[model samples]
Target: MSANKKKNLNSMEEDPTADDSDSSSEDDDDDEPHPDAYTGNEEVEIDFEGRAPTDPDCHGISQLLQRVFLRAPINTMQMADMIIAQNYVGSVICQCEPDGAESDMDDDMVEEGTIFGITTVINMTAKKDIACIEQLRGYIIQRAEKNAPDSVLTHLRDVLGNEGRPVGFLINERFINIPAQISVPLLENLHKEVLTAKQKGMQFNFSYFIMIVKFYRKEARKGKPAEDTYTNAEEEVICSKAVNSFEYSVADECDVGMSGDWLEGDATLTPYRKIILLDAKDLPHLIDDIRNYISGV
Candidate 1:
């Protein structure tokens, strides 16, 4: 390659899809301004540090990867290593690369005049975890940048040690499946824990609240006293009533489970309650209305 060719290659590698627009808007490029400076309409990049294992990092990049890992046919561990090696952390952009045969060049762009494979630009860091994030970030940025420069861009600080699902729980608490009959008390306990975490400025990722109830009838015992037999109709009636009443106070049930009662004992009911899983966007509202949630929000 001639000296000019070598210089051009280096430049293309530096920024294969660099925009050279002369727009005066700071949002057009990678410049930070005062929080209030930019209008909300303009494209901007923001970073967030979430508190829950499921809370998406920044632009849901990590969460997207997690979903991909779960469904991907390839080895997750190897993919993680590849991502890290490519320094694919932070905001990633995915966009088309142009071919060299095309002589037409957008003079305003700093990109190479040639087309290539899709470009993924990383922040380029020594830390494997950080690099992984940057690689993703670059991939996302490129995709978004393919359109107008103002289309999309996002980023997040590194947290994962290795690529897998983020490993953190709300206040580091484990979730348990219990009967809905005790949801009130359990919710109250969660309210307390959440309130304390909020006071200390902590973050967590459990955001859903759920409840399920099953009813059964008691069968007559030959050796033992007859357990009261609650009929299936009676069980259904009770479960339906409970669900209807709970919806008024708590979130509407996204799903519900029901089962016939086991023979023996007075008709019996078991309610499985799961707190609604929340997203990062919903955390503040949850923290503020935790009392309402406990009481019947």
Candidate 2:
């Protein structure tokens, strides 16, 4: 990745946590609940609601996608709209409103909803004609061709190019600090939603799943070489659940987020993107693994 792109990605990824920390320090010094106070640690009832994306959600969805795509030249707004239009798949994470809350708030007075996380699947084979989908497909293929080994490259081509076997691009994104516990319900619900959609004759009958997962490569330590670590640690469960899978690193073309302060001693961190291809049948197993991993089983 170019230096500018790396800088941009790092800024986007780190700014939220930095701002949160600042807000927390300020909140701790005061006894009052300020408008901008951080209450992330407080116990509150939240819901993993399944809802279709609407016009108002386009901006938030696009913002979440920016972290995934980095500085890639994909029209995330259009991609968000596509996800919204599909409507049959995906779920959004939101804080539940208390019962007996007044419904008289004006549109302008109401705050813009926060989309804590989203997990969904997009039909890459069936929706290849869409502009943003086409862009995403071309981008993935380009990166794989440039960085992946010949074996992985051949496998990717066979899977994505096969007309009879549809593939789903699984999207799992959230704020960097969102707890893994949230992922368990989100993924479990996604599996159920996908099954329900298929039962209703929707086009969610995917044969293979393609995931572009984020991870960090801890720089070499002592005599040991660099090793990969999951950015979302829970995703390690998904990797373990895959039976027939192919993975390749695309860190060369992607941005590597900040590393200096987050490291210790001489060791540094290099952010990377890994493309994983797995059978769709493993979705249930993956969900189980995530639940077990998060629950510390």
Candidate 3:
């Protein structure tokens, strides 16, 4: 990773809660109602005996309330006025889209690394916390789509099966920082685990990953010296600037490998978005001396 890329990661990964705390507090305070104001808890009689016809468009609570409010001694407008007189607000609540349905679907699509209608799972062992892993998965997908459009995401799936279970590595919240330390193992272990499976007659679409996540320092000046010095004290995990998808697997380099045959030019140093592609050599070195290499990056 370049210095600028690391800076960008820092900005993205910076702890959101740490910045300009007073300004955020003020924004929260602005949304609150006056302390002296009180919302009424008094309940109105439904007046079922004086029920009125329901509107065709009305549904659920609205339909039930229509029977009472439309014909009751007090109409809807009158009820609204009463609430306003008490310094309270009212809104006609309506059903919205099913909660979290769209978000869940998007998360699934990302976690599966679905691209060009193909789905690949990265690590089989990393599925303990479905929600957290899904979140990280979604983040990776969005970043890849935005940054690594032309790059091919090296797709790999467990040969055992791809149903009713997680197929990718467990991604934790801590991946935002110390990327090389935490993430390199994920890719390394993934290759080893799946290769072992392949030796046992397990088949997969693709294999191996040369992935590294690195973070760097950034500084800015705000005119005043005191305000000018800004460091990423709150580490934030941001999208990788360099993402390269390859068709090569490190396992293929092994002569005795059962699944893949060695092929030259299989690995392409393609840039993801404008970010430079990671070198094939970088993968092994980072795995071997991740702390030292990340520090130098």
| Cα displacement (Å) at residue 10, model 3 | 19
Residue-wise C-alpha lDDT for candidate 1, range 19-70, written one tens digit per residue: 3432133332332111222223333222111111111222223222332222
Q: Which ten residues in a row have the lowest lDDT in candidate 3?
A: 44-53
Q: In model 1, what is the error at residue 71, expressed in angstroms?
A: 7.2
Clashes of each: 56, 0, 7
The local distance difference test score of model 2 is 0.63
Q: Which candidate should be chosen as best, given lDDT against the real structure?
A: 2
Query: Which lDDT tens digits does candidate 3 get at residues 242-286?
Result: 234322112222222111111111232111111123332333453
Instruction: Give the residue spans of candidate 3 off by over 4 A.
Output: 1-120, 123-180, 205-286, 289-291, 295-297
**Total clashing pairs in model 1:** 56
- What is model 3's C-alpha RMSD? 25.0
lDDT of 1 at 13: 18
- TM-scores of the candidates are 0.19, 0.75, 0.24
